[model samples]
Structures are given as C-alpha cells and as structure tokens.
Target: MRHTLKTLLLCLLLPSAQVLAEEVQVAVAANFTAPMQVIAAAFEQDTGHQVKASFGSTGQLYAQITHGAPFDVFLAADDSTPAKLESEGATLGGSRFTYATGALALWSAQPDLVDHSGAVLRSDRFQHLAIANPKTAPYGMAATQVMAAQGLLEQLTPRLVEGQSIGQAYQFVASGNAELGFVALSQVYRDGQLSNGSAWLVPAELHDPIHQDAVILSKAAANPAATALVDYLRGERAAKIIRSFGYQL
Candidate 1:
C-alpha cells in the first residue's frame, strides 16, 4: 500500500516538473567549452532545464549571430563582441555582463617542457608552437601580445601554427602536432589545478585582461529559460564552477 501511494505521488509531481523545464541554447566560446559543459550538466540537474551548448571562436559565433543563428545566449571570450552586439541591436538591452576574466597559459603536453616563468619561449629547444587565429580569437591576440612583449613574435613567427579556435590550438599540442601552445588557463585547469602536462600561467601584465562577457540575444527575448540560465551563470553555483576552472568571476 505504501509503495502504491509513493508511486501515485511521483506520477503527480512528474507533470509539473516537465512543464517547468525548458531547453536553453547557448553559443559558447571555445576556451570555455569544458567548464561550460560541466556547468550545463549542473544546471540541468539542479533546475531540470536542458542546456544545449555550442562551442566556437567568438568571432565565428558573432558572425553567426548577426546572420541569425538561433542561440538563446552568447558567451563571448571578450567584452568587445558583447558591446558590439549590443550596439547592433543583436542582444536584449542591458542583458550583457562580464561573466569571467580569462587567463592565458603556456602549455606543453610533454611534462616539463614549459617552465614556470615562460622561459621556454627563449629556449628554442622545441619547434612548432601553436596558437589560435589572432584575427578571430581573443586568447590568440593575447598570446601575440605576450610574445611581442618578450620580443619573440618576429623571432617565432616562422614556427607558429594558428588554429581556428583555442580548442583547436589546444588539440595541436595535445595531439602532438605542435610541441606546445598558448591556451586558456581553464582549458588545462580544474579545481584550481591542472590534471597533467606542464603549464606556465602567463603574467596578467603581459597582456590585457580577457574579460569574457555573456549576453541574452534579441532572438531569445521571449525565452524565460534563457534569462534563467543567465541568472544561473551569475549565481554562486556557477561562480564556484568558474573559479574551479581557474577563471575569475
């Protein structure tokens, strides 16, 4: 009799939960893919709202949005793109904010290949360093700035391979196509630490802070789920996850 009563109660609650659930479509920056995936899972578990995350370079995603992509939210790798979207009427007014401050890391798949102070760039001991396309990726631009500051940009240009996105650049090193690369700290870190490989956390002064922003799109104006997801991002749960991945919230 008790089991029958519990089953009846469960059946009654299921419909209400289903009615409240909505899926949110999110366009995420490539460097933020891993962390976003974790956050998305947590969100679904906590609120029963499904998150469909699509990852790409910020520039590519911005172009797609302008051309009418159906993403409910846009998480850009830099503040400028969100600002541009706001100016172009692509975003819901006053819906944008900096979600995280990014950090760049010099990483090598082979342990001990990168040093703490980034002196490996001067070593010239390895060839074929990878970076994202500076034209489309903010982290790539920051990497260039860091190289230039060290007076190594021109010197290392011949050895550089550019990826379409930070994920691709990370793959270049992870797959052994390149000896090392400059990638987002979040890519190689979790729980405030790296799992494997050698990495040098770049000096913040070497380049401008990569202030990543999130905005609700104009297309999602009617989406309560989209707004809920954005609010979740700014909440304590999301902030803790972001920090775990070495990002500043």
Candidate 2:
C-alpha cells in the first residue's frame, strides 16, 4: 500500500503524469445498444476511463433509477424521461442534453418479406408482427402510432408480439419468431446502408419525433468519469459513430 501511494505521489509530482482513470456506470436505452457500445470503447481509449453500461427499456431503467439503483449516468430513448428526472431533482442541474434523435424502422430478416411502402402490414403474409412493449419503450409507442395512422391498430393488435425492449423486438424478427418487427432504424442500418435483410424507414411524419437525451444522475454529480463520459458523447468522434448507426444528430 505504501509503495502504491508513493507511485501515485510521484506521478502527481511529474510533469508527464497521467490522470487516474475512473469507471462510470451508465444506464442506456436498449435501442441505442450498438452505437453506445462503440462509443464506450472510443471513450475509454481517448480518456483512459472505463464505462460499465446496462441496457434496457427507458421505462425499465427509469424505474430502477427511481428505486435507488446506483447508475452514474442515463441515456434514455426519449427526452421525456430525462426531463422528468431533472424535474424530480434526480439529475445534475444543467447537465442534460439531447444526444441523438432516433427514427423507427420496420424490419425483417427475410430480404423480400417487407416492401418499400410498408404494405406488407396490410396483407395476410405473416402470422406475427413484433413490437416493443409500448408501456416501456418509446419505439414501440411510435410503432403503435404508425399503425393507428394507417388505421390498422385494432386489426393488428391481436396478431402483435410484444417484446420487453427494442433489442428483444429486433431479436424476434431476427430469430424468425416474428416475421417483422418495429425497431430503431439504427439496429438495421449502418454506414449509410442496410446492415441486414430489409427495412422500410418509417417516415418521421407518422409519429412524434424520438429525441433521446442523456443526463448525469445526481448520485454521480461529483464523479469526473461521469462528466467525462457525457462530454465524450457530445464530441465529434461519438457523433460520427451515432450517425453511422442511423441516428440523427
């Protein structure tokens, strides 16, 4: 212990000293899983800090937070969650920001199963259509809105398969448990192209905009690593990764 202390002291005194790295605990929305993983890797490389993340539906994470979970930061699937946290004094003042704007997509693992105009929903070509649980996921709510706009909500409700989170909804399609699913555009798109199968980008006009926001929890208000992670997310480096996954800045 003495030797370790001595090394720290010497490093502190040296001009070329490196700051001690810290680990930030982050609760992330499931729809952002892929991009956030990439961002976390880049953040650790650039800042020499560690990020430990947990991914779930925004509502699930929010519930855990309100129940005294020890998360340092939160990246929610909707702006409302963070705003509510801030209003309830659970977040650091002035530390909230929109990190990304998300878009919904109707995706299928089979390349030709979905069509350009999303007309497949009207046909009897499939038995199950998957969606995230609207009570827990914002993307699921958007999916419902799109269906209602098309005047198919009541008709499609009985055939619907509900996943607890967007990631699970995506898996339902990927695994063929459902023929198609509503998911984050980012899940099926990367580098300005479709990463797999087929997708119809849900027109933004069909649903309310999905503005995802990030915040530093009051529990981590004094943690430099938490602050650094938030800063790293707002940097150009992270923005590029986000855009690659089809999220809007």
Point out where model 2 deviates above 4 Å: 1-21
lDDT tens digits, residues 1-249, model 2?
A: 999999988877764323323778899999999999999999989988988999999999999999999899999999999999999999999999999999999999999998988999999998999999998899999999999999999999999999999999999999999999899999999899998888899999999999999999999966899999999999999999999999999
Root-mean-square deviation of Cα positions for candidate 2 versus the true structure, in angstroms: 4.6
Report the C-alpha lDDT of model 1 over 13-74, residue by residue, as the tens digit.
99966754487889999999998998899888988888889999999999999998989999
lDDT of each: 0.94, 0.93
Show the colliding residue pairs in model 2: none
Cα miss at 191, model 1 (Å)? 1.0
